[model samples]
Target: MMASARFLIPLGIFIAVAAFLFKGLSLDPKEVPSPLIGKAAPEFSLPLLNDFEAPFANGDMTGEVWLLNVFASWCGPCLDEHPIIVNFARSTAVPVVGFNYKDRPRAAKQWLNRHGDPYTQVVVDLNGRIGLDYGVYGVPETFLIDQQGIIRYKKIGPLTQMDVSQDIIPLIEELSQ
Candidate 1:
């Protein structure tokens, strides 16, 4: 009976670990919850990519529902999400503000030129300090902010057409009211 009990204990432990691993594998990484949701977005003053002589601050966005897209020239996912952002910007539904994360101004400008600029205002975070303040795990994370400047939602990965049509546009319409 003792020998049988010992074998069963190890078998039970292995089964438990295997279950957890399987569960984790099925979960989407992009669905990870962010603590910043429903909270005020972090404030920062950074230079605009187009008008480097002038500084843009988060405070300027007060009384507006906006989308803040954290992107970098080097991030491949950012490129993938660029078109969706451009479509959003073109729609005039909500202003799209960009936080250029840890990238050179020249490269960012060139990339935008090539892909087309979607941002109404593009702020440069050369040192990534602003990104840190926003709890950014990586580039290409997007936040939807309400009129009060509170973060309403965070999309952690590249934006898809479905994400924009189903999630973002509907939320913007809801928030606008």
Candidate 2:
């Protein structure tokens, strides 16, 4: 009985330690809500992906309910979410702006070209500086902005078709008014 108790005590301690480490290290998805929500988006003047002359800033986002989709070729989930974005673009009148996160320009362009781009404008965040300012923790993040250029909602993972139909579309409609 003493031998069994000795083994069990060590095993229990190991389990508790592992559980504490995991709980402390793991990321909580919902805890990181969009900081830009209810606030004006940070101003940036990023040069358009193939055009040095045509630059875009937060000023360009005026008067429309737009989507800022953060993605990268290195992220598998971003690839998974690409098709949903393409389909949503076709289905809605709202514009989506692409922030290609921390990826090579050639790869970013190729991925979009192969998968089909839904963005009206694509900006390259080569160092993820813009994403940092936006409080992004991962790729495939999406932000919904209102007509006055305030971020209204943020979706963390690959947005599903149901999410588009239910959560997103309704918010867009409401904000557009």
Candidate 3:
């Protein structure tokens, strides 16, 4: 009986671990849930990236559905997502608001110049305070906010063309109505 019990204990432990591993493998890492979903977006007032004279504020976008893309020139994923963002920006569906996280103004401007500037308004979060307030885990995170300024969804990684076509655009269309 003792020998049988010992074998079963190890077998049970192995099965449990394997179950957990399988569950984790099946989960998508990019589908991380944000607590801010369906909640009002955190308020922020930051200087514009190109024209510092005109400050940008979250309150100004209250009555419109928009996208807030958190990016930085130093983040490689931001580069990967730029063209998708540019295409989205050109669409009449929604305006793309940029949150430039903790990047040098000159480098950010240069990057935008090299790539296309896809933002309707680019706000500089030079110290990352706004990023922290928004619970930013990394750059290239994108938020979809509804007309009432509530965050509807958050995309944790670079925006892929498929993500835009399948998830983001559909959500924006639904929210706009």
Candidate 4:
């Protein structure tokens, strides 16, 4: 009887492990939940990409819903995401602040010129310190911050039109009210 109990316990544990693994595999990597959601965005002040003498601070955006799009000139995904961001920027009233992460100023500018600058303001995170503060997993990640400065949503990868339509627009409308 004791031997049968031991076998049953091991089988139960194996089943539990398998179930957890299967669930994890079914989860989307792009849907990673951010720890910053509902929390105030990390404070940062960085030089603008086009101008080094000027600074842009987190406190500068206190009265409106905004997007912080982390991108780099060297990042391939940023190239793919740029068009979507540009269209979204043009269609929306919400400000889009490009967070240029760990990139050369000249390269960023050239890239934007070749593509199109959709950002209302482009801040340079030359050292990636500000990106670290924002918990950037990779280039092309975006954060939606509410008017009060709380981070409402974090998209871990490049923004898709579907994401912009189904998630971003709705949240921005809701937050604006």
Highest lDDT scorer: 4
lDDT of 2 by residue, 53-125 (tens): 7878867889989999999888999988888999989988888999888888888888888989899998877
What is each predicted model's overall lDDT from 0 to 1? 0.90, 0.85, 0.91, 0.92
The regions of model 3 sitting more than 4 angstroms off are: 1-19, 28-31
Candidate 4 residue lDDT tens string, 63-177: 9999999999999999998899999999998899999999989999999999999999999998888898888877889999998999999998888999999999999989877
**TM-score, every prediction:** 0.85, 0.80, 0.86, 0.86
Q: What is the descending TM-score order?
A: 4, 3, 1, 2
Candidate 4, residue 150: Cα displacement in angstroms equals 0.3
Task: Give the worst 10-residue stretch by lDDT in candidate 3.
Answer: 87-96
* Model 3 lDDT, residue 141, Cα: 96
Per-residue CA lDDT of model 3 for 84-143, tens digit only, reads: 999988875588999999999999999999999989889999999899999998688999
- Can you list the residue pairs that collide in candidate 4? none
In order of lDDT, best first, we have 4, 3, 1, 2
